[model samples]
Target chain A: MRNLPSSEAGAGPETVDATRRTLLQTGLFGSLLLGAAGATATLSGCTGRTEATAAGYKFLRDADLPFLRALLPGVLGSLLPAAGMERDRLLDDLLHRIDLSGYRLGLPSQKALAQLFDLLNMRLTRRLMAGIGPWEESTPAQVQAFLERWRGSSFAVLNTGYRALIKLVAGSFYGTPAGWAAANYPGPPPGPYQVFNS
Target chain B: MAIDDIYTKGIADGWKVVDASTLKQDQTYEADVAIIGSGAGGGTAAEILSAAGLKVLILEEGPLQTAANFKDMNDARAYGELYQEGAGRATSDGAVAILQGRSVGGTTTVNWTSSFRTPPQTLQYWADTFALKGGGEADMAPWFAQMEERLGISPWAVPPNANNDALKRGADKLGWAAHVIPRNVRGCWNLGYCGLGCPTNAKQSMLVTTIPSALKNGAQLVHHVSVRKLQFSGGKVSGLSAEALGPDGVKRSGVNITVKARHYVLAGGAINNPALLLRSNAPDPHQRIGKRTCIHPVNLSLAMMPEKVEGYYGAPQSVYSDEYQWKHGATGPAGYKIEVAPMQPLLGSVIFGRYGEELKTGMAQLPNMQSMLALLRDGFDEQSPGGSVEIDDSGAPVLHYDFSDYMWDGFRRAYLSMAELQFAAGAKQVMPLHLDSRPYESWEQTRTAIGGLQYRKQRVPVFTAHLMGGCAMGEDEKLTVVDSDARFRHADNLSIIDGSIFPTSIGANPQLSIYGFACKNATKLAGVLKA
Candidate 1:
């Protein structure tokens, strides 16, 4: 339901400042590496993106920043227990995933991407943590057991999460510069199908 | 392939099937009798009347959903398909009680598939108390027989599935009598998805049986058209004005249509029918249009067993205990039939969510538990709060309900009975569906556990899918919405032949009774049309 302004508005200093502020507050810089590792674990659980068309693949490039921005806070909250070590590792890995300098120039293009990552992170945490007993009592071996049980199964923990993420990205892209032209979604609405040839 | 296959293929080839909400008002027409609903009563009436050569039109407010469309019959689609917002609404106080069904076939689409004729004693009670002439068991026997045959109602020939077995085991352990309740399903696969809309078309919902037959017999059904008011002239119904919901999900101009009919049948179920009458402002000196709403409110008890029961893999509801139904010296209220109900993981999560963090932990043990519902046949009392269904400025029916203390006490008793049964059945933990109370670990703890509970004060949520009585049928106009013959007291051609015409709530699933009454009423309507 959230409609973002077009890519042309990405140059606004207000938007840049806000994004930077959110990143700093949430310590996204530190959590980036861990988030990537979590995302990898999540992606492993997913069956490959069957719904995404070849053209749809391009939307993924512009989707990273917003996806990460939204995802970092939740990831940090989940990884808080080991934030000091996990934060440094996560940030390093995220930087490796994309060129931070290029993203800084085209932050709006990366907004959807950020949102998708964030969604992935949230979903991973939900599946991994849900119904598992209190974290305090969960030993390292138990956590490993939980990961093995959920992470590699064909009934991947991340399928629903990825579906939701794709839907969000689709919504955002249609509302932004990538708009209808990027996805080749029809416009002005086609007429109803005629039952008869006439 | 098969005859039904050819028939379905032919129908699918010919008709213009539109989702009710997508229906436009540009296509308006007239009919001999306009039946406003497509559930048990309305569907049967449409079939009979249409076959009898009367032009019948069925108006349903909900979309026409089929078995193939029910793959995702979870909470989201439930809101769209079922009524009372998926489960019946409780009083604002959240005492657990609910109304049922809103889709094409009404509650029949989401019902438990159990079928029972109105017991002979119940008919006698109606005759003795209300003076409802010509409605004795004998008068209704033929109709009931026909309906039963059409629905293929019969007791389960196969062994009760694992869930039912668990319930039977629990009942036997407690020395309670149990039986396989008859269901109207043919070729049931024990696919534990009845409440979510049966996928196989095995469950004989009106959508599959009566509505399809009615349509085949030339009964025109207009879905998503909500009848706002009964058009009246000279103290009789002339037609009705209905506003169709626009594609944008709001009422729009050019979407309102008026249809003229010589006869009108209000089968909008118990709740909406009365609200429609009230909104129409049709003469009702009786002031009894929306009075005497009776919901057979059910209570749920979760029995934590030692084995991984996998409760959601079988029929949604099958086993029952009618032993306590008419208990000895039962002066206050009739007892209930304890039936095992299938609750899938998602739904189980919602029910478990009510138990708070304890249930969160219990979810880890989900595969180990079995659950069942206690369905009570409650008596109608003047003290029970009556709800009025009136139209808002936008012409949508708005419902107002207040749960009575008397019903709450019965609910409490039902819950206790279930918990005791579960304990006797050797459950390690027994959880009452009471939101305000903690789950009891033992039967000894039940009294203390439930005693301090304030269902009304805390507003615990109760859901009922079986809502009956709004436009009740009786002998006199001052006492009911329609006369014994299902004719509206004031309107010449308008009648009611659904659950809305039940003078009082029957203690069982009302599908068979509704069908029987509709068939009988359709015969009467046919007699009038023939004349």
Candidate 2:
């Protein structure tokens, strides 16, 4: 763990490129992929290729789905439906919402998010950073542990990644009426105003 | 009873409203004055200039969403359609979330309707520090009153909902200076969905009032056109090149547009106005265009009230306290105003920032959640130099704001105050919106914990809905981008009539400040153009 104020020390002194490079070199990606000193080659290969998923998502490459799915139950907890078809449907809907939101982000933010996802999706980084091999085989406890690890990580990048994931999941889920209903919200109050759309 | 979507009637009555997204070929507009951005500033300017018998063109980047689109009162839909970046805008490093509006009416269409004049202390600070003139309390009172009367601005008469009432109750108990917030509305339904577009068309936003009036007075409005850059020569704006955005309002269509005007008004607000200037390579001999951008950086505290606060109903903000606002003066360490936020599920969950079972459990108490936010008044002290607006590789505006230790100290103090107030208002437990914070049952416990907590950026989530001060106005060209008359210092015939003209952060909600300044500056510009 490192020690420095995040806003001043972290935001300054390091460019986005520098941060990504440093994150890859010293951390989880380092031990996994860079043992052969192939970091630069691997890093260049990671960009621009996964901009879209084969499933026709504008963002959210196919590899990101399993990781997000594994984290959903832990992120939503009791909010997620019991392990059944209903839960699967809700998860799919939430992923769709998350995908739409991600696609709508500005170019810089989308670029940053893509890099974060790249780090998480790669086999080497996933094993080291998440402490798991494949998200499909990851248990809820493993997901929770990974989340806690990142949330408590000294690196601001990991914390930011954690925040982005949690916010996307929570905000997208809670934005729905079903989420509101489950949360005991009575929904928006009725008003006298109505609109007749032409 | 159905509320008439005014755009339909206005268009039927011969208003020249164009959806640029529908344009197939290149277009050119010739106007006496062209306003880029149709929010509080642009909308206000359009009405005044159009009324003065000048041909005015208003270009909006977002779609022309009306009451018809807002009737659903859905947060997700509203954020997607009406807000900037689908309400996903943040500081460059993702440390602070920015809630800015992008639609035709701009933020005024989606704001919580708290109309506050620029606080006297803030005005004095601007004058004393930035050498700003013609913007003192006395000089601005008439303009403020005129805009107030024009927009039906008055103290909200409705009873405070439980969420706002908690702040009032707490302030009253603590002997703090709290008051009912003024709102620019007519026959408001108190629906608490003002953050969505107002379905009742009663909020007196630019869409409902000034833009429609401008249209009535023969002004033309084109929506979904993004201004690319101003073509400038010899310290004067020549024309602007723009491209029509698609219906999704993200990608560009092939249809290009050019606007030629005798005068150009930049009212794109804070980060945007500065970014446009920077992108256009507008003359910046002093390099002051994008400097000093301030967002009233916000930190919030959540309280689980004993009573059902049900923050998602009634008027979103009807009460506020200014006890700490000017206590230490403007240039001191940082001071903040305390207000409450409506704890709708999505926003609440985002703020709470807990996960797993804790998230579900906390969310289940939605009806009882009362959120208090402190607008940490930045950009006054040397330490609080505020952010700068920089355009990314794609020419999109990105704000780089740093959280100084000075501001973090203010945040720590504000958290303590909010927790104390929540406890005074009989909250069961209060949690400062920090990743390390948990629910504290007592004010003393919260004070101790918050004091000891590490005040880091990612650890404590900060947010800003109020974007202010990028192209600041002052007498010194060395220090400011615009003059007191809102005229660009470097570019002749280019005026900025928006929140971007403030030399520092207004220690209050900035809608009224923008309205009053736009009214004053646009009137002067109209007079000059008429002559």
Which ten contiguous residues of candidate 1 chain A have the minimum total lDDT? A189-198
Residue range B1-531, candidate 2, lDDT tens digits: 456889998899999999999999999999999999999999999999999999999999889998888887888898877888788888877889889999989999999999999988898998998898899999999999999999999999999999999999888898988999999999987888999899888899999999999999999999999888998898799999988888888767778899999999998889789888888999988888889989998999989998899999989999999889888888787999999998778888888888998888888998999999999999999999989998764566778889888999999999988998999999999999887888999988998999899888788899999999889898988999888899987778899999999888898999999999999999999999999
Question: How would you encode candidate 1's per-residue C-alpha lDDT over B332-391 as one tens digit per residue?
Answer: 554566777665544554454322124335554656677877665644445554455544
> Best by lDDT, which number?
2
Worst 10 residues of 2 chain B by lDDT: B390-399
What interface RMSD does candidate 1 have? 19.0
Candidate 2's TM-score reads 0.94
DockQ of 1: 0.02
DockQ-based CAPRI category assigned to the predicted complex of candidate 2 = acceptable
Model 1: residues with Cα > 4 Å off, grouped in runs: A1-198, B1-8, B12-25, B71-79, B82-99, B246-254, B328-331, B382-395, B403-405, B455-459
Off by over 4 Å in 2: A1-51, A191-198
